[model samples]
Target: MPQTTVNLRSLFLLSPDVIFLNHGSFGACPREVFTEYQRWQLELEINPVEFLGRRSGELLLYARTALGKFLGARPQDLVFISNSTAGVNAIAKSLKLKPGDEVLSTDHEYGACDNTWELVCREQGATYVKAAIPLPFDSVSFCDRVWQKVTPRTRLIFFSHITSATAVPFPAQELCARARAARILTMVDGAHAPGLIDLDLEKLGADFYVGNCHKWLMAPKGSAFLYARESAQPLAQGLVTSWGYSERTALNADQEAYAGRETFERRHQWQGTRDIAAFLAVPAALEFRRKYGWERMRAECRTLAALTQERILAANGLAPVVSGDDILQMLAIPVPRAGAERLQKWLFNERRIEVPVTAFGDMAFVRISVQAYTTQAELDALVSALAEFYKDKGNS
Candidate 1:
């Protein structure tokens, strides 16, 4: 593969002193996108009524249209939310899971999402079943393992498209197909998948999917979206009951049309008054990627992530949890056993490198994210730090 020739590090607003290898956590937005975000904010401040009350619906429609085009979904089927967890909460709370009903998921889900299901299941007297997927992942057996856990009581299946802790890309399409055959609804957590991978929510056929534009897509913070298939739209209710809840109280002709919008949008779009600059700036983030040929850039980033994983694991003498092809621009490499927090802080404080050390069960791993702005030298810095950390362990 040809390497990216353009220098991209300068386009981001990340600190020059810190080697940022943690893009998977909270993304770093490009300077151009941030400027566009601020422009929207200024416009909102100049006339709050015009921005939020009067013209906000039309403006938001345009933004959602752009995002919908990018994700291959109808604009009416999508609604802007603060984050993926918010989307999960909206759907989880809305579902009327009866007593003895079960919601199936993998063991590799995000912590906050797991908490959402745990609390919801407890309140509703339902069971949340997390099927264990063994390491050294087998794609062939992946769907079977998950399907085997499903019982007649299983009402829904929820899993991440790309897992956060393990950095493995689950076979979401296959799982969705399987769940559909069994008359179970599927909701996909695509938090890290928007810009990192090719997506067509319509073709993927999940009942509901939520993704973060702020993560791999490089949008500003507080930018994310929830997608519902036309048939499933009525099942989703907003976390906050705001103006969009009723079409009878439309503010104006245009506002009324927005208020009488699709059941999905009308419920979730206007969630009280909040900063919508991040959501509106999603188009700018898409433009930035288009101008820079982000497909090739993502390929280069994935190469760097795989290479860094190889370099780090070679020193620690531990095998990788997932195949290189299964992941995109992020990788989780098993490291010498140690406290995850201690390992993370040591890397940040001693090495001036910002990375995440996460533990799954007893194994500890260092999750590295390579973005368009990442370079070989920063990865080299991480590799060197791990080598020193291993040496310190020997000496101790």
Candidate 2:
């Protein structure tokens, strides 16, 4: 495979000593986007009363409008949250689960979100079902495996759009359509899908979708969004109740006068006046990506990811979790042993390479994320480091 010659690392503020291949963990912000984030913070700090009291709502609306447009969603149906975990928590806590009700999901979900659902289900006397999705996944087999786990007691279906541990993209649109036909609500944790893929929320047909702008979108930290369909909006409640809740109730009482009110965005927008500068900087992040031709960059990154996957598989004589077509910007290859922690520490300490070695049950996977700032040489360095590690472990 030919190497990608374009190098955009200088645009980011990453350290010169380390090769960053872990953009999927927490995205690195570009210099331009970081400047815009600081600008919003400075504006807010200059006059707290004027910014938060007078102009915050309008500024948030503008940011939401830009973000909704990018995600192919209505601005009224979207609300900015601190992160995707908060969005997941809001939906999980708001649902009224019965003693026998079950929420179905796969085994590849993020750990924090799994904890959130488990806690909510335990409190409500409900069951959280984790279906086993085996290796070498395909769209037909994957969808069938997930659907077979659904039962009469299943009230909702929850899964990740792009899985965290395995970095595989699920067939969410098909699953959402099937769930809707069966009268089961669908919630997708699209934490890594926003900038990695072209998103269209309405067409995708998920009832509720949560995404992180801080991951693949190259936005500042604490920037994420929750999008609910018009019908699903009534079921969503804010984690931290504040003025938005009271105002929503007041509007509900005067429904005749406040008809067509923005219920979803209004009810979740304000939460006790914290720092919203990150939320306000979403538009600048979007603009920065557009100005640099993000679509082409994403395609190039996928090529790099494919090359890296091939190199890793060849080096270790290991199989991939799924085929190359199943992945986009990130790829995961299974390692020989179960000691992911030791491998992660050794890689970071010895090679100065920043990447994730994730443990999935008894198995371990080295997940590589290729971003616009990632180059061919960096991936080569990672390949060389892994070879050295394998030789030391007597696996070569």
TM-score of each candidate structure, all chains considered together: 0.96, 0.94
Residue 307 of model 2 has an lDDT of 75
> How many backbone clashes are present in model 2?
0
lDDT of 2 at 310: 86
TM-score, prediction 2: 0.94
Off by over 4 Å in 2: 1-7, 247-262, 394-396
What TM-score quantifies how close candidate 1 is to the native fold?
Answer: 0.96
lDDT of 1 by residue, 169-270 (tens): 888889998889899999999999999889999989999999999999999999999999998888899999876666677754455776555477877877
Pairs of residues at least 3 apart in sequence or in different chains that clash in candidate 1: none
Give stretches of model 1 more than 4 Å off: 1-5, 258-262, 339-341, 394-396
User: Each prediction's Cα lDDT score?
Assistant: 0.88, 0.86
